[model samples]
Target chain A: MNRLFTSLAVIILLTQTWIALRLPKGFYQDSFLLPVLLIALLAAAYLMSRLTQLADRGKFWQRPCQLAVPALFGLMILLVWEAIVRGYDVPLVLMPEPSRVLVTLSNNLPLLWADFQQTYLKAVLAGYLMGCGLGFVTAKLVVRSPFLQKGLLPLGNFMASIPIIGIAPIMVMWFGFDWQSKAAVVVVMTFFPMLINTVAGLRSVDPLHADLMHTYAAGKGQIFFKNQLPQAMPFIFNALKLNSTLALIGAIVAEFFGTPIVGMGFRISAQVGRMNMDMVWATIFVAALAGSLSYGALALLERRVTFWHPSVRREH
Target chain B: MKPQLKSLTQTQGFAVLTLVLGILVIWYIAALLMNGNQMINMLERTGQSWTYTQVLQGAYSIQRPPLPVPHQVAMELYQSVLNQAVTSRRSLVYHSMITLESTLLGFALGSLLGILIAVGIVHNRTLDASLMPWVIASQTVPILAIAPIVVVVLGSMNLTGVLPKAMISMYLSFFPVVIGMVKGLRSSDKLHSELMMTYNASRQQFFWKLRWFSAQPYLFASLKIAISAALVGAIVAELPTGAQGGLGARLLSGSYYGQTVQIWAALVMSALLGWALITLVGMAERLVLRRRGLTR
Candidate 1:
């Protein structure tokens, strides 16, 4: 069955390429090229399935081949996109081809690098560290006080509910249009998650463990450092992972409202006004990469720090 | 560690005192940081030493040098909602309503689409293979990038107004639902499926009797996230089109005119709307779960 699928996909790909080349000059002018390309692409997919099946064996090669399927699918999408845009003479202003976006990315590497530095390195990292650090410390304080638990949690909830867009302008007003304002927005975006998660994590130590500490007559600080903090690592890491994504989003979106001439959000919105869709896509590509990589790194750190947690143990 | 019952009160009291002192010191430092110009102007306006009210007013005022006072925002919020006509184009209430309409519409459409796609993926291996990765990749394309394209395409086709914005909302909102619903629908145990098979139940019957019921919590969780995402999408859609109504447009105008209070009010209103919508969905989830004896 797998062999059959691979052959079918290869046949489809060949037919798509053939038909794409065979089209008449004026035939490329019609909007129908999109539909034609889609059909041919489907055929190519079917032929590729057959080829995959033919190559399949119970070995390492098969595993890589399995991984390659999605990449192949992505390639087909880009091909179809390019073919349709070129064939139909689609205006670049509307939707630039993927190749153009890549070209733009390569050409403007330095500018993009500066934007990345301003938004990601400066604002996102600074804000995330401050917010998460403050949240962790405050959660410890709240754990010590029933009054604070009652008062601060609700206040935190309220602050979290404040829309980032609403707060961004005020932050710009307060902190100025430099990266500081964007960092402030990231702090606001990140603080609540960290606070809530830390509180939950601190509360999660087993009752038996607390009783054990009580029997030993351990001081409050001793019990917290030895018992509670380790137990809270998993939950703290969860917050960290969440904040990683939130910080990026907050910094970028906050930059949309006000910023100096540099930042990913500024470039994206500005490029769109200029009808430079390719540059916009390239900026987005960078943002997505940054978000995913940050998330991945956090997840890796979580695995290391929470190695004894049940979830990590089970995964291993 | 569990606190000794006797020491609990002392610990609690000490913690509260610490919190209060911390806040006070922070506030004092913040006040001290403000320059002589701001302090003198503040003192001259109030005709007194810097009082809490004056400081708060300074914090939240719409003018430069200080943020809008919370009370000033409260007053503006009051005027925007109570004094102005709810349907008047000039009112924040009207703009909120317009944005809310798109949000709800998009949320519903997106949820339906998400559930349908999830159903297909759950039941059909072919579709699971072909479509799931695409759905994941679709999210990688930033909504900001797509919103303008969607607006332009739909505008050229003369399908402007709420639908284009709603479509964009759906684009963002549906992915979560699809993911959550897929996980929920697949959550049914092997035994449950085997039991159904042993009873010779039809696919439709099995779905209605089992899969749909199993997916409720996941559906509700996704709905909470999706509704907020939908509202965000609606706002973003407005940004690209330069629409003169809706919360997005309100924010844009507020920024343009430097009406910080108006911007703050619109933002507060939208956040309230998002919270309200999520709470409503959560309440409905509770009701449904309670009816099913799933909630305590």
Candidate 2:
């Protein structure tokens, strides 16, 4: 009954907003009713979400209902955001509306695409591969020697703890103001997480597997290749996923220090001087999209590679 | 992995020493390559020729190098951190305190927020279903990307210095705490939760007595990660502000003038700051865990 009442109230409030939004320009322009309409819409959305939450607890509708709750909440936020920005005549410089941001994103696709290519394709991918490759090889070496594990791991941690901001300018000095410098920053930022994870993963080899290998008189090479490496795949992928985020962050921030003509960070900082709020929002959107997609891809790849893991089994 | 007070192996000690020395050696080599070129050119300008020893010495002792050797950086750090009075603008300790103030403040605020959110999610099913994904998505949006916007927006509100930087620190620090805490809060066994239920325990009673206690390890683990992250955030915030103080400003100015030794010194100071904070948290963790009779 509460859900029904809330739903009814939401529909009524939304209709009122629609009416207010559609009212004659002279009536709507100078009136305070728009904020009132938006406020009501926001409240109704909130109550409706509470209703949806209660509704979603049922087993039969669990999946779709689970999706609905957040979707509704997000939609409500965007709706109110759009309405508030448009209604208040907020400065385009201060905060561009989502619609304007979308328009800028669509209109300037070529610019954003170039920035993405520069930041993601050039800097992130190369750095990620090199950093992870170094870390993996180093982990293999460290696994063979207890001394390396004890010593180099701490050393790597120390190197990693230094923020990318500190290393980025130094990288520009070393590699110059190209994607190479950004990539170098990404490499340094990513290297230690991969190292730490791979080392931990190496230790995750099952003792039973080791015992079985010993029974077969397996050499170190055979044991590592057949048992240890395979077992470490999940942890290695964990680092890869983590480093994806770090790599993007490092590349972008490095661009802020110095960059070629085109990159997300360059565009963001440059355009802000011109008060191009739409462009800034668009860049942030692109970054968020790239970050999420990279994480999602890594997750998907992890599932494929680690199908034997129990967590993977739970999916199907 | 635990190093005991006794039975210390010489190999382990030598391994660490050798690694440090290796890094120093490499730094010296790079310094010679990068810094020596300028020195060599200077010598040429003065109608003089130099050999390898001279280049090496010049690399180490040059007023400013593209890459400073370890000793040069160490000397600079000594001059800034030890010789300078603590109140001096150039003293690393003075700047570090500026950064640390914001880091600690942000960390405290963020941890409180994360814990509050985690507790809400634990108790309220709606929040778990709705808010958790948003929290995850929030972290995926690079904090660095929005940091400038945050700085500008908050700077316009007549708020400056610590609060804006603290906001960034809070952004970086809160995620781990929420994730760690949620996982920990949910880790209570079915039997244990059932026992609490059977005793007619209130939700508040169950949480404080059962859930929060169980969550201590996760909280501390997250806190360790979060506190170090807060320092990083504070430093990053300092970068865009062109501020008069803090390690980031020191680094920025050093780089602007090609004062690589000063940059390296500032870098070293920031590292020490991170190390000190992490160590403090570790000590606190040990004390709390010991008091709780939890040895992990």
TM for candidate 2 is 0.85
- Model 1: residues with Cα > 4 Å off, grouped in runs: A1-5, A14-36, A44-59, A129-159, A193-245, A296-316, B1-65, B117-140, B182-215, B292-296
Instruction: Give the Cα error of residue A206 in candidate 1, in Å.
Output: 10
Model 1 agreement with the true structure over B10-112: per-residue lDDT tens digits: 5645545666578657654564455334766767787876665555545434264344444556788999888988888778888988888889899999999
Quote fnat for model 1.
Answer: 0.20
Winning candidate number (lDDT): 2
Q: How big a share of the true inter-chain contacts is recovered in candidate 2?
A: 0.34
**Could you give candidate 2's per-residue lDDT for residues B1-296 as a string of tens digits?**
55753346546676788888888888777778888898989899999978888987777787877777787788888999899999999899999999999999999999999999999887876677677666765766667667777887787788887899999999988977896788678766556777899999998998989888888976886786678778888888888766788987888888888788888898988888887787788788899889887663
Segments of candidate 2 deviating more than 4 angstroms: A6-68, A140-144, A197-241, A299-316, B1-14, B37-50, B187-206, B209-214, B291-296
Every candidate's chain B TM-score: 0.80, 0.86
Error of 1 at B101 (Å): 0.8
